[model samples]
Target: MDWITHEEDVWFEFRGNSPHQLVPGRFYRGTVDGYADFGVFVDLAPNVTGLLHRSELDKRLESLTWEPGDDVFVQVKNVRDNGNIDLGWSIRQGENEFRGARIHDPDGEADNQPVESDKSEQTATIKTKPVSGKRRHVGEKSEPKSAAAETQSVETEVVEAEPETEETTADDESRAPTASDVVGNLEEETEEAEAESEQETEEAEAESEQETEEAEAEEAELPERVSLGIIGDHVGDHVTVEGTISSVRQTGGPTVFELRDESGVVDCAAFVEAGVRAYPEVNVDDNVRIVGEVERRRGELQIETEDLTVLEGEESEAVEQRLADALSDEARPDAIAPLADHEPVAAVGASLLDAAEAIRRAVLESRPIVVRHTATADGYVAGAAIERAVLPLIREEHPRDDAEYHYFTRRPLDEAVYGMDAATNDVTRMLEDRDRHDEKLPLVLFLGAGSTTESLDGLGLLGVYGAERVVLDAAPADEEVAGETDVLVNPAREGADARDLSVGALAATLSVAVNADVRDDVSHLPAVTYWENCPQQYLDLAADHGFDADRVRELREAVALEAYYQSYQDKRELIADLLFDADEGLAGHVSEQFRIKVEDEVETAEANLEARDVHGVTAVVLDSDAFSHRFDFPPTALLVDELHRRNRDGDRFVTVAFGTDELYLRATGDLDFRTLVESAAAKAPAAGLGAAGIREGRIEFLTGAREEALDAVLAAVAEQF
Candidate 1:
């Protein structure tokens, strides 16, 4: 056999050649062949025999009489190899019991079965047994027993036997009696028995009713309703009423309370007395029921409150809830403090101005001034620069309506003069206008380069319109002047004339004027001669063939010192180039001074030397040789204290350079160029030549030899100048 298995269905088939069959586990339906008290015999298959146990029958149906030779549907519960099978003889097929039993027909023929009317009566009788205490006739008894035993035995036997007889009697009673007189007789007897049974039931029910009435007469009863007012009255002299607190007042010591309910506001005192703190303070709008003694006073009943408990109010409750919820192990109680005081705006601004003024003064006194000024679109002006002379003192200064205070530079005039003329023109205009209106210009000071001096001057011209100039020498070294000037000239010797000088000498002299310290020995120096000695005029000639003579004289006196002028020109030139490029309006004039001074001084010196000592000579000569053979060195010295005092008060002395026939000579202090040059000859190879013709001298030299010669020349010039 082969079986095909599907998800929810299975099919069986025989695969072998021989015929084969399969049977369900143990049970099968069959027809009853015979019956006995123990079981019924059935034919399970074509030749198989089975037994249906009497116990398997419906108990009610089994008591009813049944005959052999009946057809039945039986289930085979078990099968034996000996051809015995366990069968179930049920009046119903599987799952069809409620529809009624399937009664078997005898002789395998439907005609041999009982009629419908008979079958109905039989089923009804089998389903219902007679109640206990019923009697039976003598012929109904099929077994024998003693008196007590007979009664019990008879009752049990009659109960079992009654269903069969009663079924037949009921069928007969239900139908009209035919010519079969036996069925009619059975029905008549059954009716008479039923009538007697009805009478006995009625009498027993009447007796039960009498006993129930007697039992009902023996039980007990419960209590009645009463009032609770007698337990406690008026809450022991305090009246507690529920109401919302509408207003609260803190009077004397305690909070006086007033509450509102549906009727009206109830006045309640929170304290026992005016200054007593008996009850807890209550906040406004608290819903509460206060208990207190009602006392008569001032023609009114006042509540001398004992307890004022709040029922509901959010104002205090919310605060309390927030406080409680915020409570944490890490919370700091002292973290918050009350604000002390605050200052007015005017006071703060005044303090700030005072402090700024103090700092400004300190910087002006101790450091160089570098001013940066900004002019607003609204005509407000501000600036910064180095300090020179103190601003002129004036009393009760008043400014014009269009005027505003501005800061200005205080650097020395020489250094300030180095700034561009246009920028200085602006500063001059601003200062003059401001002074005319009696306005005070603000000032700032700094220690480093005043690179923006020209810009400040320009702003001054636009705002103040006065002759304003930055003094660069006031700063340490030539730091401030280097920022403004285009070309820095370092003269080989002091007092060299700017007009007749070679370009190198002219360049060196301008650098010295802008950044030198003055000495007493040079105190008698003529300002014009010193101006003519600087390189600025040569630079001017190179740029525009014109020099500002008045400006040069002013600068000579302003710088006024020798050592201040001797710093390296290379560093100053770098600063100047960075600050003022050639394209700037002021840069052209400054650059002109540089180129003209270097080229002209070199040309003049060379021409003068060629015409005199080295005429037609192609070989180079040293300045030191000419100096040594000519003029004698001068003696120049002064008291150090006196010199210091003069410098402190911004006074400076100068030297004069004169071009003579034998050699160009410089006179400053007690020294002359001739002696200085002779002294330098022992150390400087280039020192033996005239300063002007040094560049033309050619000696077989290694790398850096020319540069060393140049350095030597410069050193000698610095000492002599």
Candidate 2:
């Protein structure tokens, strides 16, 4: 939870004329230039590219979410003699992970941006091992056992071996080649030198043979093969591993082969040369024997490979069978019990099982899961429920300390419809992870979005890439989107009345199906999602969980308010603490802020409310853009929903909250947004009236025809009333 801060004194900025300014082991703020098969090329200066190899990264290279031109912090690993730079993964990524950054000085080898104070802190930095490569590059200053140090040693020996000039050198220089004796004397010198060379060569060969025999004997006495599940126990120890290669990634310094056994997967680094593939014949799915030293790099376990061999016939089959049996046992879930009983949820019980299985399977398989939901109280609760359920599984499955952060993700959607823009972003990121890191495609879960026809295009994009999709909506789902979705959870599809069912309720049940251990944590979640008309069962469940009516209201109100401010962020920890922990101090404080902000907005909207009567319906309209905080807390749509809830002047009335180009309708009865749009369009075709979203009765029209569109839409709503 601690983030590293990039103070001006600690990091360096480079403007590239030469790579000389780029000190190895020093942190340099850089921009993402591009990605390579081996590593990410970061440009500290215009031409200075430092390699952040896959082996150096905390997660798989493909798992990186960085884009071209994005500013990043990289530690200068080694600047080669040829000017090629090798970079190591900065454990502190983001100004540093509290903010989510990667940065550091190379080792204590350079002081390009040295802090004047704190000598202990500056010197005690992450020590980078000399990266093995064809060139064996090193930073400017030499450290013991480094390539540069060896080069320096060899130079010292050569200098020391040089003959010293005597005082007689002046006479010897004048004498030069004096006679035939001088030419004849070459025979004696050549013969003696040849004899010495032959004896030295023979002695050197004998020493090499002895060393080779000792190495072979040591190799024969191998350590026991360590299972990946318990590999953490053998960290910093030499061990052997037998498993099938799940994926292969080449780094600037090493080729990482992801080995998977029945227990788990771990990265095994094999280096033949820099930017070169190691074990070329050993491909993915090949059962292999690996001998390596288990080590921790960037918080993840890795094997520094000593030797690797492709297993043959009998050996391969035995490992393959073991893996298959283990996968079968691990992947399938035991019989599931719903968190709470509800008829609507019961209607889609079978699909819910399948959905839960898919989610659990993704975790077992190490595939990342991305939960996308609308930015609302119910939507946030739905996402949080899954997040809470899946995080423990991720931790249980992977030994990495940061596995939960890497494996599970929650992103908020502004609109309920999963549109192209959102889909494109997901596609780009998933493709990069797969192509770059050899990572499996992610499972995309839609909490409150992607259940309608409008989401078909977005869901279609994911389907094209073989990414699994799960959509859970309490409302009736479109047949088109349902058909495309992998696991659909919609009780309305089975002819059940789900109008009053909030997504939070469905998600709470589904989260239990994902990980039943968290049932107690999510028990009261269903009650928090409902703003009104909460089921008696859910409210009672909340009461049983120690969240009384007031507590539930405060939590819901706080989530709704917080969910709006940073409408895009998942606010993972904050939401988790609010929902699962529900610490009185934090919840009460946030809820108080929520109430104050909502009340202020309500007062402002009330002063600007304009009322008009069309037929028997009273149309309460507000120009939201003109009167409300458009960009701050309590968004226009939420404000409109809140406004419509309190101000119902008549038995049959519609609250028309219209912005410049868009409007939302909140009516007392079943109002068809499509029919309303059609009616409005017919009345004012030039206005280009259209339905944006049905859940909110959201309509969009030309800003130029605001008055005309508003008039026609109000008339249409009056007719529906």
Candidate 3:
């Protein structure tokens, strides 16, 4: 169908179509909707709303008489790249003002159905599930009943459908109301109800017996069973699969049952009403046989179940025997050797094995994994390494193509410590998943954090819920942290110098230990974690694994920039493309952005540096909130770190960047961070100054006492020097 351009002053109205059918430059009748200070929003169709700017109004906005639901005319001005529609006020308020009024349509195909009529057509089969290629109304059978019943089967429905009202007039009350008349009607209704009850009970007993006999005979017939691994081959064909239900989740459209057989696992969907749970009798761990038609939904294979019947006796035994092999084969594999002969990687070998085994066992048992890491280049590489490794294993273990979504997740923390807020959020989500989706508890893995005393409360909160925790830290760890977690793998715990090791290198080692098949994909990850002075062994591995030094820096910079924006989210595919599959030049383009943004920020910060000789030590203080890009890339901490990196002329100079209530310190020396904080707190007791952590090199103080805190900290630094 060809669309024609209409002449000027032509107007249109939308009946119930979406914005996809809308045409620009044509006037449309709409109702004034959501209010705003700048303009009023107009609803042209159910899902389409356009903003009519105040500048387009013919009269003052306050003086306009239009209320919500008032009919007005507007012309489509433009559609934004993000699908927002801009509308201009039209002077043609009445249909007679336009040259012609037509309905905006798609390809000239008119939609003439009323919205109310469409809703009414769905009433009879509203709450139903399709079985045997036919819709079966829930709570109502098709069997013939005695005509002795009332118009409605349920009392609630009867009252709602035909509400009783007093119709007697003042004069008619004297003539129409005898108690005897009311009593007589009540007696008739009571007798009919009793008979209706008796007939329904008899019919139900007979139906139940008949269904039992039919089910037994049907089972004896034994339809051919299809393996879930090959279910994709039978798309649109009805087939049976013998399995045990692993989990049940009620979605908005259907009740999805995760069915696992010896071949693999798949999902079977049965619908009843919108948001209504279907197959209520089917539960997790129940042995059953399902018959459904194979289908592909969003590129993932699924089964639309027509019938789900529980199996007992001989049938149950057969299902158990069929699934025996798949169960036994899920045992954890032996951990692989580290990628290279690095002391830090080999120091925590025992803990690495434990971490790898726990991950593999979680996959085999159909448990979900939640990874927490700081939003940094090293952190993302760490998370993505495990992410890339576990995703393929999930796909292979479960028959469903979407198994990875159900099994794995990675969340980035803005702070170095997993505070109570992050723990509460994780707990809330896991509890909801368990109660709503019947999923198992997730294994919480901390990639670079959760090994400090500051994270103790958050870790303890997870422990209360019995969530298994694994903490892999490249930083030095507190001894108490080892007691709170299931596995703590830190180079400091093994007596190795954890100062030089990056989280990315340790995580990639653990990723390979989890699955050795993708060793080549992760071989270059360790080298990308370091901006400069990367270990020789990691560089050699990167060269051997097909990533040159330039490519490694490109991947590293790209992740750092993307990680700062939306710091709490793991942009999975974007990072995956940069790290693993950047044959399409995505890395170079993003890295270029990283360099530009950082360079601009660094130049601004350098121009405003306040250099001073405080307490005989060279101190450069930067008022970060006033002079730096506080909300953009190169976070205050990262910017200060970068500033110190570029301007640390010698070992005597220390970079100090202060915000409203916090200050960051960076220096290369034998200064003890703990002693410095203690001395500062002793001098300015009212400031309440405390070191955030040694790794972050930050100090937290009261807002009112910020000046005193800075003075005290500078004096303490002199003592350390």
Candidate 4:
């Protein structure tokens, strides 16, 4: 392209076709074709437009004063294989500023030839290159010239190249061609050339799009597979992992699958639709392989599943066997040692091993433990011992501080039975936690409770939801209830006297088995359970640690008073302090209050006691409805325990404290509530007397037959005597 000075304006002349006229690194005169968000598009040649991107601009696009169709000077930055032009802003605005005003002529036989000009005498020749790889000179001698001389030479070439049609039309004088007519002809050619360029660009884009799709398909075929243990290192990396589904939970956005392999467990989330099941056939404990990208959400590592497939037959069996082997090797304790030297505690040796294994598995599998115990001093001691032992293990196993509180809970039961009321509360709360927080279903444990037939319904409800159950009690556990629980630790099941072994003793033994580090802290708990007739073995163990009878009693009283204050809460820290920590005045102060409260209630019950001889047995019947503080501290059950302890002589004695709807009996003689309820029901056929809670020595009778029930139960006690 060559440029000529026409008056004050500069005009461009193309010596070849439009495509070859604009060469890379050459200056060209162009028009401001249009404005766009990115930059300004300039028409450099007839059909060619180049982008002057915002980055390449010397000044702000908004500050540019050029309008559409206004001429501007630009340099060709690049010419792509697809014929796209990249333009750069040039500060040189006039044609004279360019060296020699060189023009590329593709059609010239001699690339550049001298054309003597009539404009200026101080002339310089132009040296040019042809598109066919030939170089020629415009004059005999070619050299660099001043800007004015270059302007003069460029004007000479333009005049000599003027078409013959312009000269002929000028001589006709009838209708001569004007300079405006020549300009109009060039504009028509430019419009046609632009249409051709646009068509070529569209075809090139279509080919690029096809190539991109093929590349993505190839990438999908080759995904990296990794193990669960190493998945954390590959966060944000797409990988595949194979394992068995340990659990499944559906949330608002995705279905979370707990994928457990030999190495570890990771959650794989699949989103098919909001709250919709991703793989309907997949269930808990099924073997499957998941392909997903590892990601961290809310500070926990998760896999965003892109594909999931269920394994069957040999593959599924292999996965399950691998996981079973890993669990057996890693989670199970190598050996079991009895926590006590007593025969009753040692009799259930296999059950203790099973119990420890269950607790260990719950910790390893990340299942929360729900411990329910009776709300008595002994029960609190037992529950607190397990809590003390398990919480430290939970903290050691998990990194979170609140994991102990969140994953392990010890709830106090009013009585030693998993009654329907307690079960309902547990079910409601666990279900709410599961649904609202995506928590795993907890392993329900009953210590000092849920070992009798009375708790069968409660255990069965949890069983219906596939939850695991563990029962550890110092009571005569029913065979049916024992069959329902995964682990049953009961001395009675091994033909030992359950009455001699307090629940606190049994639960503390289990606690020591769960975590050996807390054994010293919980050694005195068994002695705290017995108010009188403390076991010689446990007393000796406590005495070895300076916890004499008085100290043991103080611990019991402190726990009992604290238990009564918050009857529902476990009061974990307070109970732990009283039992595990040093005897630091807390027990002494609280024990004095417990003694005063119990003595006051006992003195009042003694004044109202009605003693009578029924069938040669002394029956000290106290109307708990009239004398006892029916709604206040020192509950009827505890009061009867104290009354029986204070008033029992060398004769057969039975204390029957009947309330509004229930009966509380604590006997010094050989009168088991289980036998009394059976014998009393035979005497009073209408009273439906039954053992309501064997551990608490409670019996149930129809309120309508209260008088008959009392008489029949008294007669039964006399028969036992």
By lDDT, who's the top model here? 3
- Rank by lDDT (best first): 3, 2, 4, 1
lDDT of each: 0.33, 0.81, 0.82, 0.78
lDDT of 4 by residue, 1-721 (tens): 3433321132233355455456566666788765544677787655667788768888877667676677888877887776667888788776566444443455776444422235566787766433331223345355679998777566553422555697687777778778999999888766656665576588789888888888678557747768787888998898888887766767534677878788777878786654567897887667898888887653578888888989999888888788778778766566656556888888887888788878877776668899998899988998888888788776655434466898899899998889888888888888887666546688887888998888999898888776789998887788999678888988888898767888889888888888888888888889999988877889988888789888988999989888887799988888877887785688999999998988888889999998877877777888898998888889888888888888876577777899766788876766666777899999999988888888788888888998899899888888887
TM-score between candidate 1 and the true structure: 0.16
Which candidate number would show the highest TM-score if scored against the true structure? 2
Give per-model TM-scores: 0.16, 0.67, 0.65, 0.62
Residue-wise lDDT of candidate 1 within 315-431, one digit each (tens)? Answer: 446534432343221122222110111122111222223323333332221211233211110000011111111121000010111111122332222122223553464345445
Better of 1 and 2 by lDDT: 2
Go through the candidates in order and give the C-alpha RMSD of each one to the true structure. Answer: 47.3, 15.9, 13.4, 22.3
Which stretches of model 4 miss by more than 4 angstroms? 1-319, 434-438
Candidate numbers sorted by TM-score from highest down: 2, 3, 4, 1
10 residues in a row with least lDDT, candidate 4: 3-12
How does candidate 3 fare on TM-score? 0.65
Candidate 2 residue spans exceeding 4 A from truth = 1-226, 230-240, 244-256, 272-288, 293-302, 309-325, 649-651
lDDT of 3 by residue, 1-721 (tens): 1123543466666864556567778788899763444677788987688888778888766556675678888998887766678899887887667666666555546642211224435655323222222223357577665654333333223222354457635456658657998999889777766677677799899999999999899877655689877887898888999898878876534578888887777889876543467789877778898988887654578888879999899999888877765655553446558888889888898889889888976776677999999899999999999998899889887766567988899999886788899999999999998887888788999998898888999999999988999999998888988888999999888889866688999999999888888888999999999866799899999999888988888999999999998888899998999899948399999899999999999898889999988766888889988898788888887888788888887667789999989999987566788789999999999998997856678899999998899899988888888
Tell me which residue pairs clash in candidate 3. Answer: none
